[model samples]
Target: MVVDGTYAKMWISKGILYFVYKEIYEINRIMAKQIVSQRLQLQNENSYPIFCDLRAVKNAQKQARDYLAIEGAYMTTALALLVEDEHSMVITQLYIKTSNPTYPTRVFTNKEKALLFLQDYKE
Candidate 1:
């Protein structure tokens, strides 16, 4: 299944959930909630390892980041953030370090590595 939201595009494949942010998009608290809600709807209450592609995101507000770190984790067994740019990588690292998400979360520049990390949690 695939869904297009205001800030991102979401889909599910092979027991994994994928979220790819729209190019140059900025995310706020409300947008964060909406994105999570969209994912929840797509997965239909089942948990999956999530692969979030943030390569196109411009910025995410602190509130959005906080919400994504906690509430955004719902129905997700693990999370793999795919980033190529330094800015996105730094932001992801900061989110992981400061927010301290309970689930297994990691950042990767390579898609294959990210998939491999998430594959372990796939059900």
Candidate 2:
């Protein structure tokens, strides 16, 4: 476990790093860096798929979203996001289209589907 806060919680499962945001909080570059760093330290791998549970996240700062969508690509083989609302889905899709992440990225309404999609990667 790298971070356990009122906003987000991070852990690993089956070699896949998981980040679950529990509340609405602005994600800045510093927070993104900490997330990537903790993922690296906890997973101890060159790269792996990330399953993000963003059902609770109200919004993410543009700079932070940009950094994670672009530079954070190197740390992840792919990204699977589970979003429960249309607003978040649209926001994530917009980021994907604008940032053009090198890695595969997808959004799902359920964690099961997201996990299944991420499982396709060898990691």
Residues 45-79, model 1: lDDT tens digits: 89999999988887889899889888888888999
Per-candidate TM-scores read 0.93, 0.85
Superposed model 1: Cα runs more than 4 Å off? none
Winner by lDDT: 1
Off by over 4 Å in 2: 1-7
Per-residue CA lDDT of model 2 for 29-61, tens digit only, reads 887777666656766656788898988766678
